[model samples]
Target: MSTIKAVRGTRDLLPPETELWNRVEGVARKVFERYGFGEIRTPLFETTELFVRGVGEETDVVSKEMYTWEDRARAASEKAQSLTLRPENTAGVVRAYIEHKMDAAGGLRKLFYIGPQFRRERPQRGRYRQFWQIGAEVLGPVSSGAESAVRDAEVLEMLASLLDELGVKGWRLEVNSVGSSTDRPRYVAALRAALEPVKDQMCEDNRRRAETNPLRVLDSKAPEDQEIINGLPKIADYLDEASKEHFAQVLKALDACGVAYHVNPRLVRGLDYYTRTTFEFTVPDGSGLGTQNALLGGGRYDGLSEMLGGPKAPGIGFAIGEDRLILILQEQAAEQAESKMDAYIAPVGVEQNAAALALARELRRDGLRVEVGDGSFRLKKSFEAADKVAKAVVILGEDEVASGNLKVKRFATGEQRDVSRTELGAYLHGDQ
Candidate 1:
């Protein structure tokens, strides 16, 4: 029989690495709570039509990258419904918000989620088919002050705090406004006219983007198109008076909060639902992410709920690419020091295995991380194994069991001591 392996673009998270992952998640949970965001977990997959409507048909996620399938039909009258492994979580969150009639409560709903998401994109370093995202959404009815520019600024400020708390250095915040939904169409139309002539001179992929979705032209990284793309109409120029003031207020709030940022006119992020204030957190230099330096990106979506057949609940959200964030952390810091179990119990004889277990159980019940070794192994062999995995090794032998005193060896200082059974608790906890 052949040994099977993980599917392409997917890999298992194991061991010491999962320690860092857990720490990262723990920090997120604590940090998000400070901002009054409660946890929300949606299904990993949803109906294909949900994404088609929420993520947008023009977006590459729906057009090229989704993992979709048809459900098995049970009856002749039943039609096979299409389902998809979520390429992103926002769509499903909003769907849940609508299904649960959250808007009827007439209050703000702040939800955060951390989980694996699926996409069939070409994988590379820090980019996988199955990746994790730490994301949150803040949405509510207009009467509840959800549409105010303060909400946008608060979200941005919260992200700045999150990155700082995580000890991410050299990070940069780039903010932009693609205008409101109404202002975007006018900008898109302007881009079409400008691209009609110069697009033929651009690359093949960009040429397609120019015709299908011109906002993506600004997002193109092709070197040759940079000159032409720069000369294209800026969204800032097309912004209506309301949108201009909304963006100004967002920036003003950031200024008051002492969160420094830059305005990048070309930063029209890769999503269709973004409007008003759009921003991305990036590490400009010294990041292991290379060309894909965006740690997270999001913006105000005043119309996304309505787009997905929900009520007019305006909101904003951001998703940190967990894989990329961890990569950056790993590169920025030295490898995490090896974690040591509290104690390893090494039995001196095969007959004393039960005794070692009893000792280990007592230590564990007292909340120590205890590892029990086989009694058959020689003391020297047991010592070597214990040294690798533990801070101390308990020498549980025949003499110690009868005398009610246990021998404990501290690996760090190469110190050994004898302690009565009652004193073992104090010794383990450093009270001795």
Candidate 2:
């Protein structure tokens, strides 16, 4: 027999820490609701084809990281479908959009979700094989204002507000435009031509990226290839008039709303579906695995619906790495101290156990947090246990039960007093 443990690349979140996670989620829900976003929950697994088509097939996520399997056919008449635990949520959300005919509603669908996602990559700090994400998407037909730059600005502004509401400070926003479908080919051609001469000097990954997807080579962070990658043709130069104007309007709206950002020419999303605006939020507080500080990333996908075999429903969305954001929040405040119970009831003897229970029930019913101790516990043992979990201890003895009065010991002030049972609830709950 073998002892069982949590799988590698996964760990359990225990008490006091899970409490912080709850607070973070509560704040996210409140903030998202203020933006008129409703919650949407897609399945944990979808047909493997969804991600292959939705997230670019050339991307590392599709080619390397997904957890996929061939579903068992129950009968000879059935087919064994390929299923995968979703590596990301955007594709599933879009699939739901098409299957449900959400576009026929003729209104924008603003949906948010918080759930677990799976990938097979090796886990390190803030990275996990099975991790959680908090994300949102706004999708609709062009007439519902999905193509407007204002929609892009609105989503960015909402993210800024969410981080602020979560007490995150010193975060930076990086923005860029990856060019539309019509403008991308010209840029790739120019990029391929420029890489031909210098391709031999680059790293293995960069060389492979150059031969396959040239835009992904720009995403490399290898220190040795920084200079060569920097000299590559900029995506900014390839944006047509429409893309340039659209990006300009997004920046203008951000400026009007007082959100600060830096435009990086090398920022690009290689998927053929990604178009116009793209952005990432990062914190430089030295809290994460260096340079892997991106808390969230998103962009406009104007043609994703079509790529996935749906109607033209343009959309923009962002997914926050919940584990990473929680890591940063932990560094900011360590453990957030939660309030303790107001009182603990210690029956002095086994005979008074019922009395202690009655008293605890009364206090609890009055909206007070009360803990009850075993009647068998000695006076010293009860006091020690009560002090750790509550601000005060109520000693319920036979004499107190008969006289309808009890001894109250206040831990903070080290004060002891006798109080009538009639006013016991008010006394324990009363501010000191």
Candidate 3:
């Protein structure tokens, strides 16, 4: 028999690691709400055409990295339908928006989601086959280039503020504009001509990209590819008047908000749908987590909705990989101290299980996190487990329950006190 294991490029977010995931998610939800973005959930799988259309057929994600397959079960009854575990969220979100008629809702629909995305690729550190992303999208009423830029700036600022709130430091933001669909083709042509001479010297992957996605050639990680890319034409210089104006407006918004950013001419995003403002957040030293330390990346994709066969609704959004963000959190934890839990509960006797459950529920109802130990363990063992997880432990033993009181132990101070059930909730809530 073979031992089972997680597939390559995938990871199991264990308990300790899940703490950071929850923390990051909490911050993301709070920050997004502050920006007037509501949560939206979409299916993990979608028809194959969604990616091919919304993500762009020419992009590496659609052409190479997507995990696509036919519905084997449906093949017997009907024509086998091709489906893909979404490699990105934007296309599916757009599909949902169209199907649900959100476009008709009027005003800009600000929505956010946090979930897993799939891709088949050679994964390395900070890169995974299955990754999680916290994404936000704005649709409708993002009319003028200046309005679009301000929206981009707002999202970027919210994301940066989220990291700061979570104590993630030493990161910087990089910004650029990929231009509108009309201007991209001309820039692509210029890029192809510039890379024609050095194509042979570039990596095999990049050489292929030179023909298919000329902008991606500049995204190469290979040192030789970097050298060739450095000498390649700058896309910003090739931007048409509208594109130039759009880029300027985006920068002006960032400046007005006092959000520091640098223009990176070569920072084309991995997807083909991105247009106008594109940005990436990274460690200032240029060494993020490793060779690929870009913590978060996103851009405006104005044509994605139309590409998905919906009305011509332009959209702007960004996605941050949860795994990469967690990596940075771990580094920060090493430099500082980890956050402490609020409370833990232990039922000393099986008979006291209901009491413990009630007390635990009340603590949580008061907005204090409380973990309850299963009644199967001995009281001492339960207390030990509680000590490991919480700063304080509330014990619901038979004597305490009989007396209508609870024994609370402050784990950090080794202090113990007996409180009546009526006052316990108030004590935990700091009302005493």
TM-score, each model?
Answer: 0.84, 0.84, 0.82
The number of the candidate with the highest lDDT is 1
> Whole-model Cα lDDT per candidate?
0.90, 0.89, 0.81
Worst 10 residues of 1 by lDDT: 333-342
The candidate 2 region of ten consecutive residues with least summed lDDT is: 332-341
For 28-132, candidate 2 gives per-residue lDDT tens digits of 999999999999999999999999888878777888899999999999999999999999999999999999999998999999999999988878889999999
For model 2, the stretches where C-alpha displacement exceeds 4 angstroms are: 270-272, 338-432
- Ranked by lDDT from best down, the candidates are 1, 2, 3
State the lDDT at 369 in candidate 3: 74
275-369: candidate 3 lDDT, tens digit per residue: 88899988644344766778888888888877777777778888888888877777666322245457777887677778778888887887787
Colliding pairs, model 1: none
Ranked candidates (TM-score, high to low): 1, 2, 3
